[model samples]
Target: MIQASISAVPGLIVSFLILAALVAAPTALVAKARSKPWPLRTALAVYLVGIAAVTLLPGDAGLESWQCDTGMPTRLFTSVSSLLNIALFAPGALLAVFLFRRPVTVAAAFGALSGALELAQSAGHLGRSCSVTDLAANATGALLGSSAGALWIYLRRQSPGKPLRDLAWGMSLGALAVLAVGGVFESRIDRVDIVARDDQKRALAETAVQADEWITAAARGVFGSDTQVRQTATATASVTEPDEGGCRLRITATTNHGTISGSWPAKTLESARSSDVRADEGSLGAREVAAAAARLAREWFPQHAAGSVQRVRPVGHGPTTVYRVTYRRYAHGVLMPMRLDLTLTGTGRVLGFAAETVADPVLPPVTVDEAEAKALAQGAAGAPGEFRRALLLARQVRGVWRPVWLVGDGSGGRASGRDVAVDAVTGERIAGEISGAATPTAATGGPPSSR
Candidate 1:
């Protein structure tokens, strides 16, 4: 996590510099005319501008909605990003204390500023998540900064201005204000739930060894053989029922470069970079990108090499394009639950990769035909719209992976559109919400004609 945070500093510093230059001269002139400490005041002004620039600016317009972090205060220091949040407010609070000669008030004001910034990030659609842990970290930094300023005044034999009583009052009021702001933001943004289930079927040491092997292979395959990758945190494994009478191990391991999270022993692996790598100049066509992605997928998941390319679409484009290439496996002419999705840059650098490990799934025979499944789905949705395509795919329902008919209206393509999944065996409605799997494109190939 620290490595990831360090990698982001260069970009943040560049944004800060651009905004600081615009405000510095005017701020310095205003402070100089007032016979105040211009340098410190101007520095404070520039710092505040930097805060706004990093926290309030819009980012990744493709994000769907605002998210909130409700992690405990005890977990804050474990993340280097949280530590950076504390440092973001320290200097400003220290400056405020010196200029105002009121440590308590300075601390409270800085705390309020932190709360306001968090609220703005969520409300202003800035693509930054609101975090309670950040609020706590920032307030801690303000208190530490103000205390240092007070100690300096005491050392110089100057009036250590604010009384202890003022500290109590200021903190009480600040707490109330921050709580109110947090409440408002919490109601407005989506909360992220972290579940820690105690259902480990494998030993911690065994999980660690498996994680090491996977991460080592992933780093070598995704990044390069020369790149050294080390796990930043301990690996964890939990037992999950993917089918009746069968349980799979879900393993997650974080590394200096990226994260490796998925299941094992009937495995799935999702390797994602902590930050975007610099893409090469120029763009590649969809077919070219798909070809490159197929090679990478084959290397990592050899079992899925026989799978057909379901879709190839450009998700992001600029100096280089980022393509989403999807592949689905089939067993005896019926789509298996196995899938591989690779997000690659135009130069074929793997930004993200998700693939299911191959295992001969014990699936029930598909009794329901495509026509019957589509009728059931349309009846459930109460819409007589024509389904662009109907495909037989395996879906998990009630802890069991079973064959299902995925029928879509193709109104919003694959990513944003709604689809219905009907159980191929029972002819029951499985999923009547947004489509979960990528819809096959005509350019690549359609689903099996038998469907």
Candidate 2:
């Protein structure tokens, strides 16, 4: 998590400097007019600009609607990122106290500022998630900074500037103002409530042992045997409702170098990032990335490496290019449920890995042909388009995994394209969740033939 945060610092620094330059001259003039220390006021302005740059300006405006995260951390200071959030607002609060001469007022003002910024992050389409945990951390930092400022004033025998009655009035008004703003914005944002679950009815020791085994394997594969891997948290199990009959146990473990997380029993590597594979300073071509990823996939899954269809696509354009590689296996021209997906940087550093592991499912006979599936899809969609590709894959229907024909125009593959799944046995349209299994397309084959 710390490494992920560190990777973003360069962009944050550039944005902060640009915002600071725009505000510097006006900030200095205001400080001089107020007879306060110009340097301290300038610092305060720059610090606020840093906050804006970090939260509001850095990310792309891709969000379609406002979102609010109502989940709270299980514990405070849960990670390095949470600690950094606390530190982010402390300096601003400290500076405000010295400039405004009222510690309580400064803290309240900072609290309001944090709330307003969070609202902006959500409603302004900044592609940032607003969380209650962050708001709590920012408020805590403001209080701590204000307390330190109050202590300094006491030690110096300086007047605190406001009487008790006036201080109470100021705090009450600030609270009311904050409440008003929050009430206005609450109805506009969508609240996302996250619930944590553990449904694996097993002994704690057993779960820990299983998690340790997987974590050890992943760490050794990504880093080496010598790296010190530690279980960051207890493994948790959640019920998976797919046709695949097993619950998923998610294990998160951190090495001294990086973090690795995956599911148990299935023995799949969900994601792992280490400092071992440093990102390349320059961009790499798509072919280079695909070749590197293919090599790694072959090395990791030697048993299922042959006769798999590989697809490589580049995501995000910048100084670095991250490639998304997917390998889909097939049996006798029918797409298998098993799949391997990898996300790698231009330097071939593996940022993510997800492999779907499933035993060979007993498939029903294919009764509906590709042409029938296309006609059914055309009827369902109520519009006509050139249907070029038809692929055979498995989909879940009424709690059973069945062979289904995916017929589409070959636009975005099976996942996002104008595809329709028709149950091969019953010739009925499959309408719900596609399947837990990954779907393969006609990218590696010729025109569809009768099954």
Candidate 3:
């Protein structure tokens, strides 16, 4: 939730700015727009049209995850939020139409324009999506605004010619328009999310081995007139005996782009399938690794007999625990030996893992170095040198300072750092105890080191 909140701050700021403009610009366009009697009907009509326009625009406006792309049902959280927003405005729009009597044409025009603007913002090309759903919601909001205006008029019972009534109506219509516009830019209207910089390295590292294997296989395949991409890749990994940590399974996959491989060094057990083991002991169960290894071998070679796990052992520990496991792969009625170098969390969950073919197996344990540690940290931080200083500084103190990569002013470059903390490593700066100063202190910290 905290991560999500931090992620959403930029979107909120954008929304506020857009909303302000929407409210203010209309007042300038039609000076008397605020003065007229309530036009509830017109507002409602506009709201409907506006919503329709926002949803149907082309370009990459809609969310493109496997779920959304494959037409899976939306999650409950999304459905509830949409329904709530719509419910909030429905009654208001009806009342607005009943009391203000807005012209249908004006309402329709507003709706259409509003939807178009939202689409422009949502589609990445225009920094907006041509989102039909957004238009629908905005239209609903317009109706609500109109109804609110009508209620205000009915309660006031002012003379039809009074300047106050005209002002009230204008204000209501303008507010509705502003709200609709604000919601689009302010609340992350676009659902198409690309991976951010921080997570990219981790994702790449995790998938490198698979990519290599796939490329290698493709290349080895016979090329034909219809051949699209052609390649074979293979990597050897070491195995160890089972120990306290989860077994290690390292697979190095190579590809034309580059050779990338990951090792699952540790695993944490969130829940054990069997209660014979203490659930609190966070190491991955030997049986689980065996199961996964068997599944992989079977999936890889369905025509061959299933493989068996020979051994599992811990190699090291830190951000990710390291393990080495020896497993056998059976192919074409022959048993082929293989070793898995697995990287896992302390909790027994797999992180990065790989498997290598073993022949003449007497491979010695490889040395783990500071470079590897730094790389792990960098991956966790999303980029090198981003959280380095902060993490280094935090090492001095017992308390925690959160990591965040904020969008900096001016250049729009990302500035990554932690909240205020005692700088024990360099002793250059120390944070004094102060209540309610966490955010301010963090913000006032000097510019982050250039990455």
lDDT of each: 0.66, 0.70, 0.37
Where is the poorest 10-residue window by lDDT in model 1? 193-202
lDDT of 3 by residue, 1-451 (tens): 1122223334533444454455544534454566643344344444443333223223333343211111122331255433544553454455544544442322333454545554454443421233334445545555555555455556777433344655565557656766765565456443432323224455556555555554334222211123233232323234443332323444433333223333433211111111122223355555665555445335432222234324455555443344444443322222233334333334543333334333322222223222343444445445434323232211212232311122212122222243323222222223344221112112123222311
Best by TM-score: 2
| Model 2 C-alpha lDDT per residue in residues 1-451, reported as the tens digit of each score | 1122335434767677888988887899988998867888888888888777777763543234578665665544765666777788888888887777788878888788778877776777556657666777778788888888888888888888775853886698678757865795676877764312212354445666867876777677765567688656655566564554555567778887678777666566666766555455556688888888777767665544566777777776875777778777665456777777777888766766767665556787778877888888788767878776777776667767788877788876544557777888888878876774665543334223332
**Pairs of residues clashing in candidate 1:** none
Best-first order by lDDT: 2, 1, 3
Worst 10 residues of 2 by lDDT: 194-203
Query: Which candidate ranks first by lDDT, i.e. highest?
Result: 2
Candidate 2 global TM-score: 0.45
How would you order the candidates by TM-score, starting with the best? 2, 1, 3
lDDT of 1 by residue, 161-225 (tens): 55776677777878888788867865776765321111134344466576667656666677666
